[model samples]
Target: MSRGFTLLELLITILVIGALMVWAVPSYSSVSEKIKMERLAKELSGFVLMAKSEAVMRRERLWIHIVMSGATNSSGDWSLELTDRDTQGVGNRLLHLSGKPFDGITLSNTYTSDQISFDETHGRPKSGRISFHPINASTDLLEMRTYHRSAIVRVCSPNSALYLNYERC
Candidate 1:
């Protein structure tokens, strides 16, 4: 004579739902972290491309400089800064790009130089490669040597490539 679920049936349903949530919570957190890292990597790659393009379009020297926050010689957050070659052809201009904290994403150590430029003649990176490692949720360090996944942008002349996985960077 019951139109709806009995007490036992309702309790069983709640238990099953609770079990699923418990199982899914960890997986969902992991997926979200991966997505945030991936997105931040893509954005960094785009920034490099934009600088290269701008250099050629403006017929001038445009460069990108990476600065690491330091406290008593201890490195912290890494910030990307833009610099333009001055009238004397020196990279003395500084401009900070503004953006929100991109989903707690952080950059890892992959780039070798603190500053890099694009050749105005070829619209290519002057030299060297830049890398972005997604900080592990487990480890807060910017260096991902201990982490497995990352993203890279390589400036290898005509062979230059972007959107590369960190392992290959």
Candidate 2:
């Protein structure tokens, strides 16, 4: 016999590899999505905290408008703007961030108003919650809650069972 692999052996190896891939792809995709959601929550929280600090340091009102809208699993755009109203009453944009990272995600907030304002004296917005949910999945939900005195970015699952690296709400 020649020192070469036979057709039968090659076919078996390919089928095993294919089977493994079929089994592993969904798990990998789910994990990837969870990571992305976590990152988004953390980044948003950081931005809000930064705005709060800026308002306190500058002693001026800073308004943060977080807007997200679109059908789930569809291409959509979201934006966050930090503005300050000058003496002339013209709004000055301090920092603006916009992106379409929420391709298959849906976002909702519990705040009464869409605009959150941090006064010069207090570096906090009214207590509320911002939640992120995947369109097709039910388990990887994440939320961030802010308190009266501080802006805390808590990435927790609303589900009863814990998922990924997040704690249960």
Candidate 3:
């Protein structure tokens, strides 16, 4: 005959809710970070592909530049720029992770040159290959750590294939 829960019942409910939140918050954050990383990677890769297509279609050279710099207002956010090799006009661009530096995230060693250029024939750089490695230089993979993010854009020779890897700090 009680319209409201007793004090003990209310306390038990509150404790259960708090425990669930404690267990779920971290997992949710991790998942969200993963999604952001994956999305950034995909977008970067797509831009590379588009650049390749443009080169072949226009019968001219094209280049995509990756700049690892601090976020918009922050001091360590990573960003990228894509330009036409001929006109050098802005084609595609992105600033990583929306300027939100996740805790414990940092970019390790990066092995790419300042710019990646594609020829009119949609071929990879005839001069040499650019490799990105973690700061340790033990691997070609870039490590994204707290307050930082790392990105890797790899284009196959002849520009027939392209791959991108992005990680959140």
TM-scores of all candidate predictions against the true structure: 0.58, 0.77, 0.56
Residue-level error in angstroms, candidate 1, position 76 = 11
After superposition, candidate 3 runs with Cα above 4 Å error = 70-76, 85-113, 125-169
What is the Cα-based lDDT of residue 60 in candidate 1?
Answer: 76
Model 3's TM-score against the true structure: 0.56
- The lDDT for every candidate, in the order shown, is 0.51, 0.71, 0.45
Tell me how far the alpha carbon of residue 59 in candidate 2 is from the true structure, in angstroms, after superposition. 1.0
Best by lDDT: 2
lDDT of 2 by residue, 1-169 (tens): 6799999999999999999999999999877777767767777778788888899999988877765563223243777678885222248878876647756666777766466777788787667777777667755677777777765546677885666667787
Which model is ahead, 2 or 3, in terms of TM-score? 2
Alpha-carbon deviation at 62 in model 2, angstroms: 1.1
The true-versus-predicted C-alpha distance at residue 106 of model 2, in Å, is: 2.1
Residue-level lDDT of model 3, residues 42-87, one tens digit each, is 4545665565566677777666564555311123355445566423
Positional deviation of 110 in candidate 1, in angstroms? 5.9
Candidate 2 versus the native: TM-score?
0.77
Candidates sorted on TM-score, descending: 2, 1, 3
